[model samples]
Target: MTDSGQFNSELMAFLDASPTPFHAVQSMQQRLQQAGFVRLDESQPWQLQPAGRYFTTRNGSSLIAFVRGTAALPEGGLRLIGAHTDSPCLMIKPHADLYAHGYHQLSVEVYGGALLNPWFDRDLSIAGRIVVSADGQLRSRLIDFKRPMAVIPSLAIHLDREANSDRTINPQNDIKPILLQGGDSSLQAIIAEQFMAADEQLVDYELSLYDCAGATLSGADSQFISSARLDNLLSCFVGLQSLLASDASHTAVLVCNDHEEVGSVSAVGADGPFLQAVLGRICGDQLDSALATSLLLSCDNAHALHPNFPAVHDAAHLPQLNGGPVIKTNVKQRYASNALGAALVKQLAGRCGVPLQSFVARNDMGCGSTIGPISAAKLGVNTLDIGIPQLAMHSARELTGASDPLRLVTLLTAFINSVAPLCVIAD
Candidate 1:
């Protein structure tokens, strides 16, 4: 078992290093390589061996890492854990250059369901993938400004008296971040300078503004973690740690998809063919048999009961900070948790001696979904939705109990190592 303090320190470093999905995948790939997992190229033929550790990525964003167990895959099946890498943020527009009133700014589009108010007046930086035409060939590279380069200042109260109560943000008119005062710098020039590509031509790019501040242990007793992209990144870290710690007796897979904050319909997203393609290659002729005994745990942060907004949550289903992992369920099938799947998690939690909680939105409020249902439908596997309870989800900065992530890691590690059959027989 990992020490709580050590686990959180490593997690904070990961959050600080990964500002976008590309960076997150890169960071995870490096860690996997260090742990002896061989990287596989999608275009090349694979020669998998029993007990071999391997991983592959799609679009430099989504990733799938697995360990082929000594046991037959069709008999023991796969222990799968799923999470996403993308988060809600302000994405740079193609025509990003804007100048008004002697101020240079960049036009940005709101990506996903972001809490706009918190984004105001925050020190922000840019990081993402950029395509460059260098040496007479096109190449894709990741870049990060690595410093506070811009800010979105809020309108003064004198300008909008109702700013506190009924203020509305126009994505087009209000959110352009100020880059400099009376500067002649173009976005392309800035990118070239950052990349040191003096002779290369900037072809295209995908960039997003992120909070310059890094993750930290917060609260008086340092009981909570405050950071950006904790919604799913936290799950990704936990899944990776659990996979790394597995005993390798059973097949274990960790998949981190991209674009979940949006509708997850992209080529590298959960709704796409990424995971299916990987599974088909791994299982081959026994794909159906393997899926019948496999289980997927979709881990995404759940909304914790907020003390200041208690009325917004169902009284009976109020998940608490540091209370343990939460099993999310919805009758409408927004989440993929069924009775059998939920029961399996419960049994696992009990065996691991980890506390557990349940969450259901207020009767009048609609519930959100995760990759659980999508993966289950795509592969015909039993899946459950679970996550650590969190506060201010989709905000520029989010919060979760410092201990909950470690608790989840413990449970998932057990699940990956367990040799028992993962299915329940229905009478």
Candidate 2:
């Protein structure tokens, strides 16, 4: 039996090891590989076997792992947990190298709705995919500037007397991260040097700035996790662990898509055909029927009730840190937790002996949406929005209860492993 402390320890390591989506997928792939799961490629034929464990990756950022079951196809459907590998960060542009006042800075674009204030003066690094030509063939390589290579400094208070009073960030002008002091070195040169590929040429890249400060267990009693990318990476890791532990009666799938933070519309995102294509191959002619009966657990991070701003949350639907997993809801379908889905989760929680929590935004406040509704509408699968409660969701470093992840793992393992159907016919 794995204790909560051990789980948190692993989660912290996962967070520290994964600085970008590319790195995140690599980390998950390594874990699944160690757990006796084989890797499959999309270009090659998949000879799936019953009771077999296999996984696959796309664009090196998105990943899907599944376990074949003993039950019949289509009718048995699938138990899937979907999460995103993306978080709010600054992405380096193509012409990123800029020289200003003898200090070289990297021009970046805001990738998502990042809480920009927290990004200033933080220890930052760069990591993403780089394209290089080798032997007249195009190849992709993942790079990580793991050390404190950059920092987005704030304007001095003396320069702006009202800096603290009305601070508004201009992404174009105010957020250029100073990387080094030089005019001769290009961005490609820096990357090529890191690659140790003096013979290779750097053509293009998709790099993002990241917090190099590692994840830590905070609080006096070490009861909290403080880290970056926790919004979705936490769920990604939890789903991976649960799927690896499950001997699911029906087919179990875990899809961690990229670009969810930026609306999930890319070739490797959840909105694209990556998942549908995989389902088609797995279900054969029964793809439609299998999807109709399939259940999707859209696992993302849920907002926890802030101690300082309790009024921001719905009074009756406040979720607390360390309470347990939260089933997020919205009447506007921002989250796809319908009556059936909510009941199913509650039932699973009961069986797993995990306390269930619910989260609903204040009526006047605009609610944040997840990948749940998009998945349900696109695939026609029954989807439920669920996650661990955490504070400072889109910040550079977020906070969460240490034990919440273990609770989610327990529920999801039982949920996926259960042999019974997700719904009753009401005979």
Candidate 3:
């Protein structure tokens, strides 16, 4: 197989393992550990030496790692790649206990920007981290009640008649997923049995309902991917691969954050101190200098203008599949990139001989933001937001170009390894 073919295979394998945010971070932790990276917890004291590789995790969801450069922490600063792990899905609520209309059901609160309609009538499962009671202490356990377990059956067309033409879903009333028969069991009871924990110890959980079906390669020659949480996981896989591939003279870091889809305010989010804490420990007093010249790349998925919904996107800047990576910008600073950040990425793309695309939302439509703005604000660093154009963003099965992920990795490797500074452009 060719190099691109090889990357495609590797990426699909990575995506298959990461169905939930917890799984995404755990899988990443394992990969980094195998690559000679030592694990460090934030609560413990850190003695990071030059040329060492260290990592830390937050809430078992977000992760940050740093590879010390050949030289001492440079005044020119650190190079960071950031991506989010949590995707839009139905989250099981605290009072998740319910038996609605003769079926055992789990009350779920919608998390992030989910395309709600796609969830209807799909076979679903529950997966995430659970805090279980254990001998007067609580332990966090990762669980995936993996099976064709739950579903939300849509209303029949025969009943509504105009279902296809004009139907609207009320999330509060219509979107709850049916799990099992009445009086069969409680969700907590089932979870305790799955983990072999005491019924009393499985006190609470932060679980999300997910599509139970396997993610597969579709289209002729398997050129397309159909998966449940590709919106951001695709970026996570690309960023981690590029970080591993990078050989930078400056410190190289990759941050996979959780809770971005809902507002990014959690301890594991970009807005929190997770990234800052890692940098402070790595650079210490040099943290200030690092922020002065440091650059962050917020990698996420951008929406490609659908051919059928041409009016919804900016007519002139329609991003397409197989169109290479895109430099996302917003006049309102929704995306943290200015002309300089975007140009810097363009230069890297050119150096790598890779194609590049640009994305701008329709003037009237509200644009989506990434970790770029939050990271920049929190660290006061120079940052750029970039991504691969994708369709069905926030949907159960998001789609992207077959070739774009590797292209992104290539561009990022070039950027991380380059010593050139990002030149600021004046209007």
**Top candidate by lDDT:** 1
- For all predicted structures, in order, the TM-scores are 0.99, 0.97, 0.95
List ranges where model 2 is wrong by over 4 Å.
Answer: none
Query: What 10-residue stretch in candidate 2 is worst by lDDT?
Result: 418-427
Each model's lDDT: 0.93, 0.89, 0.83
Residue lDDT tens for model 3, 1-427 = 1288788777777777777899999898899899888999788898776677878898888998778776555554688899999999998999887886799988888888888999988888888888877677877788887787789998877899988888888888888888887676888778877775444477678888888777666777666666777779888888888777767476889998998988899888888888888888888888887677778999988888798998998877888888888888897989988776777888888888889888989888998899989998998888888898888888887777788888888898887778786445467
Clashing pairs for model 2 are: none
Give one digit per residue, the lDDT tens place, for model 1 in 273-358.
99999998988998899999989999999999999999998889999999999999998888999889888888989998899999
In model 3, where do residues sit more than 4 Å from their true spots?
197-200, 424-427
For model 2, what is the alpha-carbon lDDT of residue 353?
95
Best by TM-score: 1
To one decimal, what is the Cα RMSD in angstroms of model 1 from the true structure? Answer: 0.8
Q: Give the local distance difference test score of model 1.
A: 0.93
For all the candidates, what are their Cα RMSDs to the real structure? 0.8, 1.4, 2.0
